[model samples]
Target: MEMLSTISGWIWNPLAYVALGIGVLFTLLTKGVQFRRFPDMIRHLRSGGATEGGLSSLQTLALSLSSRIGVGSIAGVATAVAAGGPGALVWMVITALLGSTCAYAESVLAQVYKRREHGEDRGGMPYYIKYGLKAPWLATIVAVATLIGYGFVFPGVQANNIASSAELAFGVDGQVVGVLIAVVLGVVVLGGTRRIVKVVEAIVPFLAVGYILSALVIIGMNITKVPDAVVLIVSSATGKDQVFGGIVGYAVAWGVRRAVFASATGLGEGTFVAAAATTTHPGKQGIIQAFSIYIDILLICTASGLLLVVTGAYNVKDPAGGFLVEHVPGAVAGPNFMQEAIDSSLPGWGAVFVAIAVAMFAFTSMVFFFYVAQTNLVFLLGERRSKVLEAVVKAGAPAIAFIGSSVTADAMWAAGDIGYGILGWLNMACVLLLTPVVRKVIRDYDRQRREGLDPHFDPGPLGIKGAEYWETQKEPVKEPDRV
Candidate 1:
């Protein structure tokens, strides 16, 4: 456990700085597209309604948010607050604000280079890596990494939390819950992308809305303390608060760590789903994806963060052995922190209520996680399409879920962070190199819209090669005048 923490500390040591730099760079290069075009994102969301055979933009957004707005929104925020102090919420705001621009870059690239598979368009980091950079080897490496990281490592983290939370709140046996979850998850993934999207679209809003409303109620009850909470977040984030002034480094590092984990920004997760959506312009999906980041950080994560802070339901422990703010006596920190926050206002039922809600949120995430892994599994297996390999992955995912139930939470979290962190850097590097292409595509779309034309992608005009599908969007050549 100690070794894993030390290793993750090293990886995240510079990740915070690098992630911020990527966000800032894209924000400038895109001319702050996420902000100037914010209303446009909302407009695109309602416009791209998929046909009977296609995945709609909204469904894709739901699929991505199913995972992005899962356990991380609740436990991840609580974890950030516990480790980084109330100030962690401040970095989360910055990450979301700047990170949305980064999201637009990767998502637009995904749409531009998306591949058509089994009658559906699918794309992601691997797809763009192959198409944009023309690097098959690097693409394969990333595909395999996502398979291991999001597929196996992160699912374990979710299952571990589900099991622990259920046991604490309902006295349910963790193993039974794990086995049951695995069985259900297997049934859904075997149904493929359509089923996964269908399930998430129905469930994500219900889970998100209920959780947000609960947090809102708590915030309303403590309206007076909201100001102090906001002040603490800013001061501690900048290392100005006397209480957390000494831990500024910890605050920045952990804040970024949890923000990326919670929102999955810069990790190339959103790009895959953005690719699957049927849209007239790549910029449309890019804008839609940027908006989902807002929902994840500002709406969902902020709800949980505020509840924890406003109610004083968390404790901060310094590794050097002493209490920073011991609101809960002898608590080690986990889902219990947030549960206590709610319970402080509504005693007896808070733990169970949060447990159920986390279970729903984390369960949906696990389903989406499995879908992402299988998508990569298809990538790694190549275009040959082998039922044998597909079945193996299908069967293997649930088995791992059960196994994940038995693992310790600390190791599960550490393992997930390692996978998510490495992929984030690799994907960020790819998008950085392709920023020029992303820029031209957006300019093309914006110019067309400025002329009151419905936007459609035509990659040929920009001199970008290897856009096999999108290149065909251009008008056909007219052979010299007939005799």
Candidate 2:
């Protein structure tokens, strides 16, 4: 317990405040671009656009949702509750609302400065950090951090979750489930973003809608307790509860941390998706991606939180005891609350639904993370040995999943906490320094849009020539031997 506390402290430490600070600062700098163009974003996504490279708006949305909905919704939310309590859900919503605006700015900046690689438009935090900011080294560092955090270690965690959920839901062996997930991931991701988009586009909408509807049904069934549940969540957050004492600060911080971690508004995943959008205006896609935070954190996470609260399951003590003793004792960890809610209505099926939802969401998240990692790997390693690096990273998932399945819930919760903490700090620093560039890009887009220029804002007005300003910083690369 002491080790868990220490680790949770390290991961959800005040330093994560830095990520929020930067995100808020960028949001302000962009002059509320997210809110201003919120409608235009929808129009663009539906209308579509002509781009030589990059993904359709639906594809971009699918990709971003794939990552956001995964472990963050399932394991991540549960983990936050375990560490900080139900009050943390409030912080998560607050962060998502604010952080998503910053998500828009950064992603738009990436889109404006995106480059063509192998017939596709490829850009992200690295593209903007390096080219837009004219800080090649900073871009390199940010890209490396993103590759490891989003792509490598993150995918392992997602895979672990999918395997665990499948085993719990369908009585499948963990190893067998892991292999199945890995095989599905390999098949889709190996085909690249085109295939990845198809797979996520097919699955994400149905899965998300299904989970939300199911939660609503459960909540409806327990409508009588709605007021009491809201009071508990709000009271816990405000420290009105005597049990919480004077630890309102702890609750507040935990909520903020969990929300940002869940939505991932500015943690580089949104930028990757924005860059992939086939659009005329970078800001348009940015706006669409920004809304994702709302859907993910505000809609999905909140529903899950409300479901847990409304059902009186959040207070359960032994989540692993299955649905029978579920959530009544108020456990210190895991989804005892949710498990109990499901158990109350569907008997044994509650666990099964959760397991299935977790498996689908987490599996897709693994695929999304691997793609992000592979993209950044190419950026850092150049086109030559990127394949080797990618293979190594993908291979690490099974081992991690195996370990995660065998471990206790407390340890898994702590590990995820530590990961969010470390990655948040590094990402926040990079995003803050490059914020001015985001501002410039947004201002430029606004100027263009006002002129009735079709909202086509390109950081590189002359294509590759605009990229040259930043290219001078990198050393010449020797050609690698080809087969």
Q: Model 2, residue 8: what's the lDDT?
A: 67
- Model 1: CA > 4 A from native: 473-483
- Worst window of 10 by summed lDDT in candidate 2: 474-483
- Model 1 residue 87 distance off true place after TM-score fit, in angstroms: 0.5
Q: Give the TM-score of candidate 1.
A: 0.96
Which tens-of-lDDT digit does each residue in 328-417 have in candidate 1?
885546688888898888888788998898888998998888777877877776677888877877776787778888888788888888
In order, what lDDT does every prediction score? 0.84, 0.68
Highest TM-score against the true fold, candidate: 1
Q: Candidate 2 on 1-483: residue-level lDDT in tens?
A: 668768768666676576567657766777776678777767666767434555777678878888888767766676565545567777787688678876787676677667767677788878777776678897788788777666545665666665556655577776677566666666666686667667888999999999899989988988999888787777767778664424556556767776776777656677776876666556677788888887898888988888876765654222233322234654433444456668887799777788778878887777777678767876786545655776776665544555555555556656666666665665566667656566665776688778876665434442333443224325322212211
Compute the lDDT of residue 168 as modeled in candidate 1. 79
